[model samples]
Target: MALSLCCAWISILLLLLPSLSHGGKLLVVPMVGSHWLSMQEVVEKLSERGHEVVVLVPEVSWQMETTQAYKVVTHPVSQTLEELDNSFQEYVAVHLTQKPFPLNALAMYNTSVHVFNSFFGQCKDLFRSQETLRFLNQSGFDALLTDPAFMCGTILAHHLSLPFVFFMRGFPCNLHFAAPQCSSPLSYVPRLFSFNSDHMTFFQRVENTLISLLELDYCNGFYGEALKLSSEVLQRDVSLMDLVNSAAIWILRFDFVFEYVRPVMPNMVFVGGINCAKKKPLPKEIAPSLLNCGHAISLHNVCELEGWDFSFLFQISLMLFDRLMESPLNLINKAKNNILNKNIRIKLYLRHSITSGPRRVGAGLRFKRQILAGSTI
Candidate 1:
């Protein structure tokens, strides 16, 4: 069975290159975090490059609601979301004598993981999943790209029986896994994990390990069990991990570029920057993280509460630049309108009428002069 799966992917990946040579469609599913918006450029660029790409994102097309889908993502996404939110609150607190030191990793990790699991449990049964399924059944996607954050990509590939390519948008906790199961609780415990960073100080590495422990908790509680049910939903005991992990030796792990270009295994290629030809630099909000500071988290001086992820900060920057770019365009349009206004033309005519000294050649002047000359004669 594994060999058959291997053969299937080999055939598809082999086809992926030739199809790109001709023009193929790339169907991508976005994870609902910082990486969500980042994938937009990849989709846009592929579309620009004569390839068609349709992105199926969780929150991009939908509004926030307390429905099934909302509950599903809110927990997992919101836990971290709140910690991030509270950082700003804490920052303000200390600024106004709230607390001497800022909120630390322990609190932040706990907050995020709680939110992360709420939805991680039932993403499939969430809203529009059937619609997504229906669309995928007909979409005829040439390639598959998904973030491992949600194990849905592997699920989709297996059900559709399509060629599979797994993407870990961020760094794996097990930099060089002693075990394929990166989900071990040991991986997440602070100070217990190492992320292949030789340069990291002792304390930083400890922090990385703790973060990994938090991740392990999330997976065991949410992601793993969710995946175990996936086989039931798909009506077969397909080792979802095979597609999630590497089912076969020659299969592709498509996380080409991360913050730090660590020496990874051949099976794990950092093809992240590969989706787009050049690179998309990290946001200014992002700086290097310490400990198992895998590529996923970029921590800068854990200052108390800032209420914004580096991702959201980048979005705001883009929005400000957009508004600024439109200002000159708006001004030029206003100037054009001022020029075109007939009221201005009328005002100019009135000014000319008022400034008219006695006319140089008046209608009555010639007649009056003729009459005067005749009388004199």
Candidate 2:
């Protein structure tokens, strides 16, 4: 009876499999940045998996060409990303050389606003373009995947009347998104630009609070301009905050271990180190050393020693034990199993496995110290 029931269950699952796949026409609009490169990887992967991926990108000089993997549609952007990049580099160089200890909050705020304002202006032009309008309505896209770097994608998704998923590179700590949607408390979870650790002193908390307030002020002022401009372009009334709050899902590209200990809602999912290659060929320089070394030592994200310059025998590999976010509930469940159970199926690859045994010192002590020292307070 048990054997027959198992066979019957398998038959039922096989019969219902066609209704399970969630692949469809996905429209992606990513802001240009090194951080936004992860979205490109996602678009390629989605296209490989039989989903029709369409990207509407800024027609910048440095932008990649449209290929067979995905369809690319470009619109003329007013501002150049080169100028923004140079300005950011100049800001970093000045701050890093002159005053590295206490971060200049004003300079950071000004730089961010300057960059975002330019990008937002370009997005405004893109939306106003007739070509962009034709695509948005006629594309027959099933879902929207966008990077909320400047919230232009958010506005576009809302205007198009589509369910959108935010592809955030990391948690931005925006009060509009994190506080209201995720219930991320300001008391513990520090704002992105605040430069404070999760564990904070009394005064640090006060600083965090002040930073959050200033950010709110800046966002309100800046988004007011965006609201008026967007309203004019779309020929309709809309609330920016309301659209921001309506995000169906938020995909954060960081692990819980790296983040502060805080509550994250079900909609907020973390997929850390997903961009890392599954199987990377060993570098020729390092490959020879690994063979000669009697005992193979595996390091985690430690590329260079603090004081040593010599070629080291240590091989680094980043491994994380966490749930990855994916569409289609059944696929996500199966993928999670594959991730966790891979070690069992792959034997020879386990030769480089770091010991699972308990260490003499506390786990992740070095990482903790580094994080603590790096933070403002």
Could you give candidate 2's per-residue lDDT for residues 1-377 as a string of tens digits?
A: 99999999999998978765667998898877655566778888999999998888777734466689999888887767666555555444444333342356555556666656766777877877987888678988888999777777777887788899988764233743453455556788787656787788999898888777776566666566567766775688856566577888888776666555666778887877665524445567655665454433343333333432211211222111111111111211111111112111101121111333222111111112222222321
lDDT of candidate 1 over 152-262, digit per residue (tens): 665666677666554454423342232244332332233322333536666766666656656445445444545566767677664434445542211223442323333
Q: Which stretches of candidate 2 lie over 4 Å from their true place?
A: 1-22, 61-65, 94-103, 170-173, 176-180, 221-225, 234-240, 278-377
Inter-residue clash pairs, candidate 2: none
Stretches > 4 Å off in candidate 1:
1-21, 59-109, 119-122, 126-131, 175-218, 236-240, 247-263, 267-377
RMSD of 2: 11.8
User: RMSD in angstroms, all models?
Assistant: 26.0, 11.8
Give candidate 1's whole-model lDDT: 0.43
Question: What is the Cα-based lDDT of residue 45 in candidate 1?
Answer: 64
